[model samples]
Target: MFRTEISMLAACALAGAAHGQNLADLSLDQLSRIEVTSVGKRLQRVADVAGSVYVITADDIRRCGATTLPEVLRLAPNLQVARVDGAQYAISARTGTDLLANKMLVLVDGRTVYSPLFSGVFWEAIEMPLDDIERIEVLSGSGGTLYGSNAFHGVINIVTRSAGETAGTLVKGAVGTSERFVTLRHGAASDAGAFRVFAKKRDAENTQRASGAPVRDASRHQLAGFRWDGGTPQRQFTGTGEVYHHRTEDVLGERDYHGAYVLGRYIEDAGGRRTQLQAYADRLVRERSRTIRNTVDTLDLELQQQQLPTAGMDLLWGAGWRLYRDDAQPASPAALDLLPRRKYLHLWNAFAQVEMEGAAASRFTLGLKAEHNAYTGLELLPTLRYSWRPSEDSNVWAAASRVVRTPARVDRDVASPPLVPNPSVRAEKADIAELGWRGRFGSGASASLTAFAHRFGQLRSFDLNGATGVFANNYGGWLRGLEGWAEWFPAQNLRLKAGMLLQHPRYDAAAGTSPQPPSVTLGNDARHLFKLGVAWDVRHNVWVDFHVRHVGRRPAPAVPSYLAADARVAWRPAPSVELSAAVRNLGEPRHVEWGAPATASLVPRSLLLQFVWWP
Candidate 1:
């Protein structure tokens, strides 16, 4: 496989040998100047960030030919993403995969979307037109000091383009063996502001089980959203809203989930000082039966400020408040249900960070945060970082941080047969250290490498007593990993990107705990992952891209290692229209990326045709 990838790259290079300029020249330049805010809570050049971070640009998204957000995220080497079925994905950073992944924090345009019920994201419920996405930043280390709780392992921040940038009409559609979807969007400028509205509908076929029998996982999605941006550069105001309905069929029967949210943000920049205020309201409803339903409502508010307190120094501070109200109803006699069906969860946090520049292109940063939650009264997170630039286009950085994950409702309030929750369960904690380097070898090539180690305490576990078990904090472990990625132009019109991950995790159950191994209870994670991609400009108007990835075997659930490949070809028949064809899971016909053997859904090779028109 490695030789095959190398041969493909060599072939692309030879094909583009006559071109004058490499396609990666401009991209490499833009990458160095790309500003990211996830690390310090303020805009900073990628080279200046003191932690491991990967940025996926808009151009990459356009060329990738992916229909869903999760598919696009595969470009980030720091992340581990697996498709569970037609409409579900298990994603994490620096760790293996989990259907109920809870440690990673995800934000869409500054709005948190993870459910408080399980402290995990319901990917099917979060949908938006892909064209509006500007960039995605994947931070592979802890962001507890600035991002507050649930940033235990990593953070994914999805930023959308400003309304003004999308001032036109766009129609997109796609047909595939596994799914079909269409989207419509229109944007215009009025006296109030620049605004755009979009609507999308999609349907997916059920996946097959290992035995070739169809599973009950088919789904349908309907989504609509709008964004409006107003005011001047010195004082900007933005408002956004979205509503969605998702329906899924499973063994239990058909279920419908509806969600809606409204958000507003105001920013003031004056005299080298910036201040931002944001607020949002969100609601989610899931209907199984007339009497069995789950509903969650949330209200969030945040304030942030950035200033150059003195020469060669930067200061940042922020505070946020969020409230989640969950009303749940048990489905049947054996379901694990939250006691006191209606309950409220409140979280408040404040954080401050300071960066000081030193001699010889070096910087030092210190950050601290204090958060108060319903389950954990108060938690303190602190971080220290240093970065040194050895050359104009290279950076060496190191960071150490403390992060905590507070207990979710499932951990503290559940009361059901064969399971019991303990309100006394403490928060899960981890101390992480990271060292990384990012540099450009030349104008046409760049690479990033990071080494990280984590020491965890009070990890989630269970204590079996007689006939039932209670949630407890009796697991601790050490996890160490190395992540590396590189992109280069071997020819003027060809670009190659590759990445790999090596992870080692060791966990031990505390004395007197259940005898089950930690891997069996805590979920299984793959130890190695590799990905390679190629983009070749076959002609001025035709482009082709190829991607191949490998995932190592998992132990607990006993899933064997697998390799998958994908390819896309795009043609621009006119300036305003594009037509493309994509094949996913190529070469490998049927394989399972997750779940137990008997019930796991098999992902099959499929092809799609897509069209986009701008008028």
Candidate 2:
């Protein structure tokens, strides 16, 4: 049945093309029109944003044949995405690429996903139905002025489709060499609102160690979620909730985790003024190992307002409050423990940004954020930006900002076999500057280039005092880099994109004459990175997508440089049915992307077949 349907579509497309009816071409203007909200915390044209930003659209996701969020992220050339195993990934931007990359912030529909326990994301535990995602906005620079602390390097925001747009039934299934997944979704529309519910399950096999042994990293996960949207465009209300359970078996032992969250949002626009209020609550429990367990609960509330107070002037402001309660314990005496078995943390923040048109075809933006955290009494983040449009198709921008990464629970409270608590640890800070240019040539080409520099202080390190190790802020560093990308469309049916990155990173002790501890190490720093992608619409209903990436050798842990390639071919038999096949890591059978002692298993080449049905 599937083959027949696809064959029918192929024949139709061939017939139509032979009749001189060409498919619509995707122009540069259309691509630039995609609006993004992560840059300034409000909707803005992608071309108008004064930062290094990239957008992964729904079409890009479908054509890439990505089964996980990190796989989808690989399309963004500005980001460094590495797979550690079947379920774990390490992702960052510009700098600090490691297993625990704490400087980057990640959010799903305005809800933060970074765990305060370690200030890093547990990628394995965060799962969502990929079909529901509308777009992902990636900003490769500091967003501290608007997002507050921990936005020191970059920010990623994932947006989902509106319930009204997904009013139907969808079922999808996939089987691959290493994993199997299934998803079901149902949506409905009523006089008062639109709602959708979805569920997904996945199981993955283990990977092989460098020594050619199975790593025992198999995993399984299940997730369910729902979303509801109501009211008119002028007065809208949204409610969403999700729950998930995951289990994994690794070298250490078996681990289990489960979590749930609910969010409510209300928005109103009257007389050219817009207001938004949001609230959310979440709880999580994790058995990290056989002898370690932790539980956390969080409640957050926020209010925001946006308006065009005057011609050529735009302003947005918001305030938020968050509370976190945590409980941790060790089942065995040899396991790690928190200084306080139970603890509570409070956070309050307010932020504002104003944009105004200046003389000489330029725009200026000023932003500031004031935040108070339990560990850091008070902190201030500020940014200034200027953008100049020399022509209708070109833009030049510059910006400067101050950002910080606050101490996490493990930094100041952890006490275990190898880590000792240190109450004196301070926040890591950086002063960043950037300049960029973006241009569009004719209707078939576009390009962007950015250069950035950063000065850091109060970097985190370990202090060994006669066999006991304690965390401290005793190191500093300087980082400079260049990132650029170009896109070309030689034919209406073909599109190509290429990107490159180069960086120089250095670190040293803040206090002269003090030797660095052996435990203190900089993250995986790649000096050069390159990526190329191609998307060809073979026919009106068939497409082929291919990507190639080359990562330079990293310093610590010493991962040799490697090149990887991925390809996917997809066919849409009807408006509601699709079939696709994909191959990943085609360049090498198995290779390690990260990890020392070579603990991380090698990422193996895999092939998958997928089918999607919507009615």
Candidate 3:
């Protein structure tokens, strides 16, 4: 059945490619001029951002042939995205490569998505309809002053299209060796407002171990959501809600999880000034191995204002409050347990940023944030940045920032079988400095390079000297790296992008000269990384894209270097229809991207066919 479905989709794509041109065949010149908003919280040309930033547009996402958020994120050069199983992924930026990477902050439409339970994101539990996403903005350096704690290394903001922009019906389906997925959506626009609703379902097969045995990591997921946008010309209102359920089978055992969230926002713009009020609530429940069950509920509120207070200055300020509650229960007495059984957390923060444009094309920015949490008292974060524009096409920028990662539930309250609580754990902090340059050459070529150094204090570690293991902030370290990417459109129809990263990281004991753990599993750092991508408009309506990536060896669990490649061919047969075929992991049958060598499973190659209909 899978083969038959894929064959039909391929046939349709080929037929469409043979036809005439379509709107999807946008010129490379137009794409380079796209605008981005994450750098300074205001819309600006991509080439003008002073930081190491990357933008993944909707067209780019369409050509990548990715089925999940993690797969789509692989396109960003600064991120390390690793596949752990059929439904799990380990992703981070600049530092850390663990199953629960906690250094990077992620937001979807202004809503934070990380779990306070582990101070990390559970990739498998977060899902969205890919077609609804407008763009993904990735900042490869500290953003603590604007995003608060946990934005220690970087931030990823996923922005979705407005309801008015999607006023139609869309249906998408895919079948492949690894998974099957389907989606249905409808949108409508009226004088009063615009609304959209969607439903999606997916099922995936299990991966294999090195011995060619099935790992039983298969999974299934279902998601439904709705979005509404409306209001008068001066006042704008937006509301969104989603519900999801997921089930997975793994080596440890079977797991079931469900979650729901609702978000609302009101924005007003007048005379070069803007104000926004936003609120959201989320609830999640999980059952693992038939032995452990956990539940979490969260409510958040924020108010922000932006204004051009003076001819040469721009000001942005915001305040936010959040409340979180967690409950854990083990089916068996000897199973997993959480201290206090039930816990409540409260967080409050305020932030402000000022940008000044000086004479001779120079700009300076200063930002500060203060946050108070239940575990940690008041913490302050500060950042300073300067940019010099020598010409319209070239820019030089530098920045210094301080960031922190606050303790999580696991750090202060976990009391599972072999682990004990440690209420004394403090927030980990870092001071980072970065210098970068961006330039646009003749024609459609552009490049960016960045060098950064960071000194970390109070890093987290696990101590096993006592009867039960305890988490502590007992290490310090220095990390330095160079990262860059270049893009070129050699021909009118061909485009190429290449990126590389190199780093050196070292750790030492806070007190004595004792040797640190040989297996630094906390933040697995890789020394070298590289990626290359190519997109060619082979014909009027046909497009082909190819991507290759290499990740160097990591310490601790000792993950060896590996190379992977992907290719996709897409065609628009009609103005309202598209079809594509893709192959992932073309270089190898299966390989382990992360985790301990002894128990790691292999991620296998996959062939997929997809179709989209809009009318």
Tens-digit lDDT track of model 2 for 1-615: 000011233234322321222335446776777777787888777788899998887667777778889889988878988887777887889888877778889988888888889777888888788878777888998899988798988898888777876778989999999998999999999989999999999999999887888888899999999999999867888899999999989767877889999998888878887888989999988886757788889999998889856899999999999998988887764667888878898989999999999998999999999999889789999999999999989999999999989898988998886678888989999999999999999988999999999999888887777678788888788989999999998999888999998899777786653635422434676788999999888998888889999998876767788899999988888877778899999998988787763676899999999988977
TM for candidate 1 is 0.94
Query: What's the TM-score of each model vs. the native?
Result: 0.94, 0.94, 0.94
lDDT of each: 0.83, 0.83, 0.83
lDDT of 1 by residue, 565-594 (tens): 999998889877889999998967988888
Worst 10 residues of 2 by lDDT: 1-10
Tell me, what's the RMSD of every candidate? 5.9, 5.5, 5.7
